[model samples]
Target: MVINFGAGPAKLPREVLLEVQKELVEYGSSGMSVMEMSHRGTTYVKLHEETLELARELLKVPDNYKILLMQGGGTGLFAAVAMNLIGRTGSADYLVTGSWSAKAAKEAAKFGKVNQVVPKPAKYTCVPDPKSWKLDPKASYLYYCDNETIEGVEFNFVPETNGVPLVVDMSSNIMSRPVDIKKFGVIFACAQKNIGPSGITLVIVREDLIGHQLPTTPTILDFSIVAKDNSINNTPPTFIIAVVGRVFAWIKRQGGLQKLYQDSLTKSNMIYAVVDGSKSFYYCPLEANVRSRMNVPFRIGGPSGNETLEKEFLKGAEQLGMQQLKGHRSVGGIRASLYNAVTIEEAESLRKYMLEFLAKNS
Candidate 1:
């Protein structure tokens, strides 16, 4: 079987896929596929409510939080967050650690003043020290991306925002680890990475943070409307939501977040061991402490990354039944995305190939 390591639209647990397959045509005696069921109908409504419930149970989302199942991906939330919350203070603070956070800050600038906690760095290898952050006490919210898939940087700890509302984009690492949901005012994730499919974007907003949107905010983008209507303001992503429910059920079956978090560390450590032990053959750009457990970006030929050798490595990886091992085009190298669905056996296979390649080429 080919091991998939794409960053987004990544792998789903085989068991979840199998379960989805069984219900793809006709779902649980509803006499119609989930895709054909109306969002208002009992069948789809139950599926929607159950999916949200499973999400709440798995994440331990508090009763005060409203989990909305919406259509836009992470990019849409870049603007949606600003429109909704920036109205509170007419500005927001952003910690720009990597590409995604940088984009979010830029989008927020269109709506209000954006005070980047730290200046953009020459490269996205490490997060700036929190002590050096220039936080605006009057800012509407403090926004940060918990994990940056392309740059392979993840925050080791949550940033303290004093009393300010803390908003996080956990798109790439949402369910891979345990999180304290109460610490943040809003947590949004695109489902394709660790959850399920691409069409759904899960937004969990604290109750009070709902309804504070800019006057011009679109009805659909307003968190209050989405939450008040129970994320049924329009035709929701029914099929994607169903598949996400299956994935959550799969997660629950696997001993929940703690188990998956341990599995994540194991899977990531296996590959990082090869990279670190390779001496000079392989190099990871991010700092050791901030290295992402979900997406690992590394270079094949030294620190600057020799493109030719990196291309050769990917070619060999593909030949060995590994696919999507190539890094993002913007930063050419190798990236192994160890999302929740990527098994430890697949990680071991990649580790073995890296060692073999090192021995042959060194």
Candidate 2:
């Protein structure tokens, strides 16, 4: 059993992949492969609608929200959301907790004014105290990332938007836990980490937020056009969408989001315990309250230890058939992404490896 722990383009459950492999040749009596089928064809269209319907029911997304399948990843939505929503007020409020949110705020600024709400030090170690946030009453929406894949930090609490729409980039954390859809105006995720492969994106937007986009916004980026077209404005990533649909079904069979969340907590706990017990041998920078349950990045030989040791750890892990333990390029260390597909057994195995490595290096 090969284990993959890369962040995004991460692992899908073996069952899902195996079934997909079978259907890849010929998708369920349709004779032609999904690749050969037209996007407008009945077989592909049914899969498209099924994907949206499953997403709605599993996520418990409300009837008022219009589920849109976007083409670009979460980064695309960074600009798409800004152009579509910032038209009303000409500005938006951004809570810069980590890299993605900061990037979102920077991208949004290209369209209009961006009001930043952050604390001193501008660190990604933990969530800024919401009480200290300087929310702009006239802003178009309040935007934040639910989880930071690079820094391994996650927001423990939702923001109180007052009267503004709460726009979220849930790329790394969506579907990993239970979330109330009624609180937000827009919630989007790139289908890579937790959902499926890259190429397809999911955007759940409130019906009222559909139209009224900036005149300068591109036709495809315009949520109004994309929504009306039912996300098939172009060919759409039919193959990837088919894979994502199966993943959604896999999550449902695993007892839905609640069980997935518990599995997440359990898996992360295994690795966290190893980090905490290693006495100074291993280190996780984020505070306990905000540590990510999905992406857990920890140093190989504590804070003061030589960074050179990380390479040795990676080599050892690779020798043992483990892969993609390296952290983000910006934050160099190790990050084990425990997405829904990564099992608790793999996490426990990693923890065991951590202890063994610590003992040898120490």
Candidate 3:
């Protein structure tokens, strides 16, 4: 009855959760829980291999790309990427469109110099023009966040970096839609938001970018070491990985990336239409072209309002079993995270509730 809208550690598919529950006590007749299995044991090893293969197949990842199931969350990658790639070059280009990307840039600066290419004031509502980005030829990689969870801004089109390797933090919108794996050199995401639970991280890196870690990079943080060892340099988050494997199986059975893309579009469109049709009762401040399908941020008042509207919205939603509609603290507005697990029906129900609330409160 609960609708979870927290960005990370968000809601999971019911089937996946059920499967995890069933296997919690006995995993494939191993007579032990998945968490109790030794990472180096054959059973765990097989599970690990199969999960990686499934992820690659689901994403249509090319053979040249190595999928590493590593530890550390999306934030860890922000530093790992800089340490591994921004070594001798001592510089990288970053596109700052939202909170996550800005954080990535800040982390990168700790390793070396970062050239921030922010969106123009006029085009803040849209993706920055790739041609306008001041790319340093000596830079190692260009980093960006595919979707900003807090700001509700997304990049509808891929940015062309003129041959510079593209590194993206897809934590908030990883498997919500289809993506061309060949378009980027490395794509990393924390599994909690869309794939599975909070402990495991997914990293898809082009083979060429695996090595070249700086001397200061920790052994566990080095992508080359992790990729070379097949992400077994140390114990992994076995339970989370197993759960993610089940989620991947569910995604494949539900119709793969194309179906997910269509579902996301339909669900997002349904809610957005309601907001747009609400006239001045609701306000979506994000630029139209860059609106995110995974996270929708909206305000109840036209231009200005206090916390009254938000408080009422949460109270009314909770009363109707529609939970977690509060916005992020950094951005004081309503945010509904419609990840892969969220059905169109739930979104519609929320839309209906919003309309009713407006009618009563407006």
Candidate 4:
């Protein structure tokens, strides 16, 4: 059995896939695949409503929050957040923890002023201390990425935004753990990581923040317009949303977010233990506290890393039916993305491989 560890478009639960296979061609006697069904038709509409309701139920999203299904990945919502809320005070505060947040701040700059709460660091390793952040109380919103997939860094705690609405890009970490739905004004995630596929983006925003888009904001990017139509303003990604619904159902069956969070802790710890115990053989760059539970990035052959051994590592993993252990190109190393669907057995197998590689190479 092949265990996939790629970051996005990562492994989905096997049972969910099997369920999809069983219903792919004819969803509940519709006589057409979900892909072939019209998004606005009765069948797909019911599916869509159920998906949204499932999401709200699982996330414990408050009545005040509206969960919107939209296109344009996480990057698209970067602009959407600025377009929708930056007009409130004509500026936004951003906590630049890693590549994704840095990109978000840059994008928000086009629509309004961007106040980087802290200067961008030379290397993306850990989150800067919140005490050191210079936040603006008058800013429309404070933005940050909950987990940086590429750097393997995560915010262990939410930053106190000093009453400024907190806007977060949780693309890589959403649904992996429980979150306080009321802590922020907006929480957006792309479906590719932990939720479903690549075509849909989920935005959870406070109903109060729905309107008030910038005058120049496109109708599609306008959160108010999308929310007004129940995310059916234009053609929605029917198949992707359907798959996301299945995944949400799978989460509920697996005991919801708390269970997934516990599983995440166990799976990541299994691999992290191997890396930490390897002496100089393996090294993870981030601090112990801020290291990501979803994605673990480590270098082999000391902290500077040995590219030769890294290549050998990937080859041996592939031979054992494990793949995508390679890190991001910008940061060369081995990365095991312990997403919700990557089973404990898969993580333990990776841990075993790491130890075996260490023994043979050392």
Largest lDDT belongs to which candidate?
1
Which 10-residue window in model 2 sums to the lowest lDDT? 298-307
Between the candidate structures 3 and 4, which one is better when assessed by lDDT?
A: 4
**TM-score of each model, paired residue for residue:** 0.99, 0.98, 0.97, 0.99
Model 3 alpha-carbon miss at residue 50, Å:
1.0
Q: What is candidate 4's TM-score against the reference?
A: 0.99
* lDDT, residue 308, candidate 1: 82
Q: 2 or 4: which has the higher TM-score?
A: 4
Stretches of candidate 4 exceeding 4 Å from the true structure:
none
In model 4, which residue pairs have backbone atoms overlapping below 3 Å?
Answer: none
Q: Model 4: per-residue lDDT, tens digit, 217-336? A: 998899989988999999998999999999999999999999999999999998889888888789999999998999999999987899899898999999999988899998889999
Residue 137 CA displacement from its true place in model 3, Å: 2.5
Sort order, lDDT high to low: 1, 4, 2, 3
Q: How many Å off is the CA of 106 in candidate 2?
A: 0.8
- Mind giving the per-residue lDDT tens digits that candidate 2 earns over 69-169? 88879889999999999988999999987888888999999999999987535457988777888999999999999999999889888899888999999
What is the overall TM-score of model 1 with all chains considered together? Answer: 0.99
RMSD of each: 0.7, 1.1, 1.6, 0.8
